[model samples]
Target: MIKAVFFDFYYTLCVWGQSLEPRLRKITERYGFEVDPERYVKARENLYAEASGSDPTTHSLLGTMQEIIGSYCEFIKGLGVQEHVEQIAWELLQSEHSLFAASAATLYDDAIPTLEHLRDAGFKLAIVSNWDTPLDPLTERLGIAHYFDIIVASHDERVKSAKPDPHIFNYTLAKVGVSAEAVVHVGDTYEADIVGARNAGIRSIKIDREG
Candidate 1:
């Protein structure tokens, strides 16, 4: 019997109001750089894939921030904007911080209902996300924080590892006071959430709302 349900944040329970492309475009424009949005998006995806595949536990918050800035600079350089790479990177980072810090995510239509059902059913609930920022306050602003007993993020001080790595899952299990056998994880990312939970010896369900 499953005593707890762990959920992924982005694309599983909630999604960002604005994706990276538009934000990137906005920043580039502010800096007088003309970029191909498609190219920029592809570059970001490639960089993110590489970063996400690595062991996040090896990097601290500052290290991660530096990595992001470097990735942005690489993309900007690819767009022929060689000047002000560091400045642009810093401004872009600040923009991102301000944006997400404002809690610009919206819950799915079924998210609240499902979470409420599970909570009412006496199942312990938690949010396990790979998000770099603090998740508790964002969930709180989304009006669903109270439904979760634990909110764990990859960037959390206690969780230095991201999904697809068992460390984050292990930390969550410890915090939730449940064995992996007693919990089920639901997420949209197969490699991250599904494999991560499996690696942690927990059952998992993949949810692809689009497909």
Candidate 2:
């Protein structure tokens, strides 16, 4: 018997808005640089997979000095901001996220319905995601924050490790006051959510939007 239900954020609950690149370009321009939207979008296209946050440690990697300075070096060069390459690269790197719901994402058509179903069924709801930002603000922005008893992101201070690391799942289980045997997680990533929840003694449902 499931007492609680946890969900992943990206792809599971919402996906990036279609204007992602243009919005990114707009942010870059605001940084005092003239970025060709075409070039900027192209640059981002090349980094899409790496930016997906699929790997357990991808969140940590994005903050590393090497990943920061190196990942967007090509983007900066392509946008003709080589003069401020390092600085601009840092800015763009940061732009990969921030206020996910307000600026960059929209919920799937069924997300609210599913959450509502779980909540109405008397299941405690939560969000357990391998994300860098706090999940509360995003969930709150999407109007689904009220459905969750707790929302945990990898960056949440209470989470000692990201997904695919059982630590986070265990921590969340503790927070929700449920045994792993009585809770289940739903997410889009296999290695991160499924594997992590499994390692934590919880079951999971994987959402494969691509297929």
Candidate 3:
């Protein structure tokens, strides 16, 4: 029997608002980068996909920030905007980070209700996310923090490893006081969430909301 349940954060429990594009545009303009909105979005998507597969523990927050800045610089350079690429990338990073830190992502319609039901059913709930930002504040802001027994973020000192590395999952399992065989994880990403959970010897469910 599954005694504990773990969930992924972004795209699984909550989604970014429609203002994401406008916010991106604002940041790009503020940084003096002449980027086509559509192309920028596609580039971001591709970069994110590539990043998700790699191990996040290899870089500290500062290192990751620098890496992101470099990626953005290269992306803009490819777009024929070569001057001040580094400065503009740094500005864009700061602006996007602030935007995300503020109010941007909203909880899914079924998120709260499902969590409530799971908690009521006596299952220990936790959030295991491969995220750099703290999950506590975001979950609290979303009003779903109470339902979770723990929130494990990959960037945290306790678990520097991201999903698919198994370190984060092992940490979460230990914190939840549940054996891997007794827990079930649900997430959207196949490579990160599903593979990570499996590597930790935990069962997993992939929730494909769009499909």
Judged by TM-score, which candidate is best?
A: 3
Work out the TM-score per prediction. Answer: 0.70, 0.67, 0.73
lDDT, candidate 2, 56-167, per-residue tens: 3444544544654665676567666757677666655454445313476678889999989989989998888766656687778889999998888777665657778888
The residue pairs found clashing in candidate 1 are: none
Q: Name the lDDT value of residue 124 in candidate 2.
A: 95
Q: 2 or 3: which has the higher TM-score?
A: 3
Residue 133 displacement in candidate 3 (angstroms): 2.1
What's the lDDT for residue 123 in model 3?
A: 99
Q: Give the per-residue lDDT of model 3 (tens digit) for 43-68.
A: 65565555566555677777776666
lDDT scores of the candidates, listed in order = 0.78, 0.72, 0.76
**Candidate 2: segments with Cα more than 4 A from true spot:** 19-96, 99-102
Return the clash pairs for model 2, or none. none
Candidate 3's C-alpha runs over 4 A off are: 19-49, 55-60, 69-101
TM-score of 3: 0.73
Query: How does residue 166 of candidate 1 score in lDDT?
Result: 92
- Return the candidate ranking by lDDT, descending: 1, 3, 2
